[model samples]
Target chain A: MKKYGSLIGQLVIGALIGFFGMLAVLDGDFRIDLSPYAYPGNLIILAAAAVLAVFSAYRYVSIRNLAKQDLSGEEEDAAEGRMYRHYADASLASTLAILFSLASMSLSLLTTQPLWLLIFGLVLIAFSFIISGILPGLMKNMYPERDLPSITDKKYAEKLLNVSDDGEKHIMLGGLYKTHITMNSLLLGAIVLLLFYSIASDSSQLFSIFIIVGILAITNTQYQFSIRNK
Target chain B: MKTRLKELRARLGINQTELAKRAKISRQTVSLIERGEFMPSLLIATKIARVFKEPVEEIFQFEEEELK
Candidate 1:
C-alpha cells in the first residue's frame, strides 16, 4: 500500500512471485505433476487470474479513495467495508500463487529428482507475507492512536472535526484492518503447513512460532487499547 | 470516557451531522468519542474542545489507571 502502487504494482508482485515459482520448477526446489497449460481446462485458471487482477485493482482504488475522503457517520462505515474488500482482493493473488506453485511442484514430481527444495522455497514465500502482515497488528499497539502524525496537520488538527478534515485519512482505519486481515489469513495458512512440516524438521517451526507469538501479542494489545478500556 | 459533547452540541444548536460536517470528521467519530468507543487523538480532542469553546482537558479527561 505504498502511495505510488496501484493495480500495476500488485500485478508486478504477482508476476515476480510467479517467476520465483517458475524457478522453483527449474531448480527442483519442489515437485508436483502439472496438467499441461495447453489443456482447455487450464484456460479456466487463466481466466481466474484475470478476474483476480481486476478485483484487486478495484479494491485498491476503493480503499485508496477512502484514505483520501472525509466522509460522515454511515459513509465512514461503508468506506471501511470497501477498504476491507480491497484487502480481501489480494487473497486472490495469494490463492493463484498457491495453485500455480503447486502446479509447478507437480510437474517437478514427474521427474526423477525430488523437488524438496521447491517446497522450502514456497514455504519462504508464505513466511515472508505472514510475518509482514502480522507485524502491523503488534506494532499498532506500540503506536497509540493518540499521536498520529496526521492528527498534527493544521488542516486536520487545528480545525474542528469537519467533513473536510476527515478527507485525507478518513477511511485509513478500515484500510489498515483489511491489510492486516489479508495478511493474517495468508500467514495462518502458511503456519498450518509449517506445522505439518515440523514433524520432519525444526526449521518449519520457526515461522509458525513467530505467527503464534505475534497473534498473542496483538490480541493482548487489542484488548488493552480497546476504546472501552477505562 | 462518556463525554458532554452531546450537551455541548445541543447548546450550540448544532445537529450531530452538522457538527460532523463542520469538523471534517465522520459522525461516527463524534459518536465514538462521546460513547468512549475510541479515544480521540490529541488534535481531535482539541478540535472537540474548539467546537464546544472549551479547553481540551475539560472535554477529555484521562481515565485514572486502576492500581493493580
Candidate 2:
C-alpha cells in the first residue's frame, strides 16, 4: 500500500511537470529552436523534487515518532510540541528548496545546454516546497526548531530556579522572553531576507545565510544556552 | 552545577512525593531538579523557595563567585 501510494504520488508529480513543460514548449520560448529536451532540466528537477518531498515527509513522521516516544510523559503540552515540530519541518523544507535550486543552477551553468525551462521548473519546485511544505508545516508548530523553550513564564521558571523577590522575578522573565524573541526574530529576519532574494531573482544570496544560520544554531544552542543553563 | 536539593529536603525531613505535592510539579520533575541534571524554570524555583520558606536566592545559588 505504501509502495503504491508513493508510486502514485511520483507519477502525479511527473505528469503535472510534463504538462507544464509541454505547454512552455508549445508557447515557443526555446532559444535554440530545439524543444525535444528543451525542458530536460525541468524534468530532472521535477523528478528530484518528488523524491525529496517523499523522503522529507517520511523523515518527519519518523522524527515525530521519536519525539513522542522519548518524551512520552515529558510533553507537558502536546499541541505546543506538535507546533514546534511543524515549524522545524517548515525550516527543513525551505532548506531543501534552496539546495535544489542551487543544484539546478549548477547543472544549467556547467552544461552546454541552455536550460531556461529547467530553471523555470526548478524555481517552481522551489516555490512549491517553500509554500506547500515549509509554510504549512510551520503553521502547526508553536516555536521554530532552532529556538529554546524561551523561558516559558520566566517568573515561574525563576521560581523553579529559586529566584526570589518580585523585582528579580521580573528581570528573569524579561530576559527569557527577550531571548526567545530575539532568537526567533533573527531566524525570521534571515528567512525574510532569503525570501526577498529569491523573489528578486537572486537565490545565490541564500548560500551564505544557510552557513551562517547553521553556525549560529550550533553556537547559540550548544554553547551559549548550555553554559547559561548550567 | 550540583545542587543541595536532596540534602535540603532531607534536612527538612520531607520525602520526594511530599515535596512534589507542595511544588505542584511532577515527581519526575522534582527528581530531575534534585539531580541538578535539568534546570528548573522560574515558577518552579519560586515554588521550591516557598516550600523551603526562604527566598529563591537562598534556595538556589551559583557555586562559583558571583558575576559581580
Candidate 3:
C-alpha cells in the first residue's frame, strides 16, 4: 500500500483534471485563446528548453570525461554508476523538454498567434529534436564495450533487452506488469466516465468508448499471446 | 534469500562494478544481490561464486521459512 500511495495520488489528480476538462468542454462556451500570452509563454518555454539543454550537455560532458578517465579504483567504479544514473535522469528531462516544447508549438499553431511565435516554436522544436537524438549516442559512450543500437533501429527493443542482465530483466518485468494492470484499470474507469458523460450531456460517447475498448482488447490479447506458450 | 555479496566483495577488495564485470553481470544486479532485493539464478550464483572464489551456498543463505 505504501509503495502505491504516490501512484494512487497521481491517478486521482489526473482523474480530477480530466473530469474538469470534460466539464469545461461540455459547457458550450469554453474557448482557448493564447494570443495575449503567446509572447511571454513562448519566452518562458524557450528559457526552460535552454536550461534543460544546458543540463543535458553538462551531464553528457561529465559522463564522457568519466568514461575516458582511468576507472580502475573502487571509488571510480562507483562514480561510473552515479554517472549512469545521472545520464538516465538527464535523458528523461530532455525527452520531457521535447514534448513540452512540441505541445507549445501545437498550441501556437492552433491559436491566432503571431508569425514570430511560429518561428520561435519551430526553432525550439528543432533544438529539442537535436537534443533527443544525441542522448542515445551519449549513453553508448558510457558503455563502449557493448554494441548499443540506435533508437531508430528496427530491432532496438529486442537488442536492448538482450543486452540487459537477469536482474535488470527482473526489474523491467515487475515494472511492465504493474503498467499493464494500471492501464487496464484506467481504461475501464475511463469507459465508466464516458458512459456517465454521454448520459448526462445527452451526447453519444460510443465512438470514444469503442476505441478505448478496442485498445484494451488488443493490448490484453497481445500480452496473452506473448506469454501463452511460455 | 540473504547474500554476503557485499562482505565477499569487500574481502576481495573489489567494488560492485568490478564484481559485476568479473561475474559477467550488471552492476545493478550486484547491488540488488547485496541488498537482498533479488534472488539470482544458479548460473549467476555460480558466476558470482567463481568471482569471489567461494561456494554458492557460502555466499547465499536461505532462512528456515524460505526453505519451506
DockQ of each: 0.09, 0.06, 0.66
> What is the per-residue lDDT of model 1 for residues A1-230, given as tens digits with 9 covering 90 to 100?
57567877977997697567546444554433233433333334334544544444454445555657776544655565465444555555545544654544444454333355356435534643453343223212222222333433556533423322342244456666787678666766566556545533323478656868698569658856875587
By lDDT rank, best first, the candidates go: 3, 2, 1
lDDT for position A216 in model 1: 59
How does each model score on lDDT? 0.54, 0.57, 0.79
Point out where model 3 deviates above 4 Å. A1-47, A147-153, A181-217
Of models 1 and 2, which has the larger TM-score? Answer: 1
Which candidate number would show the highest TM-score if scored against the true structure? 3
In model 3 chain A, the worst 10-residue window by lDDT is A25-34
Q: What's the candidate order when arranged by decreasing TM-score?
A: 3, 1, 2
| Strongest candidate by lDDT | 3
For residues A86-173, what per-residue lDDT tens digits would candidate 3 score against the true structure? 7887787677667667766776787766777667667766766777677777757676655677878888779889888899899889
Evaluating just chain A, the predictions reach TM-scores of: 0.31, 0.30, 0.65
lDDT of 2 by residue, A1-230 (tens): 99999999998996687567556555653333223553475457656755555555554555455444433232433433454455466456646655665666655665555666456546656664645443433322322322222343445434445523333244456767788668766875676556444434423557767876886777568756766987
lDDT (10s digit) by residue, model 2, range B9-50: 878877665666577654545665666656678878888888
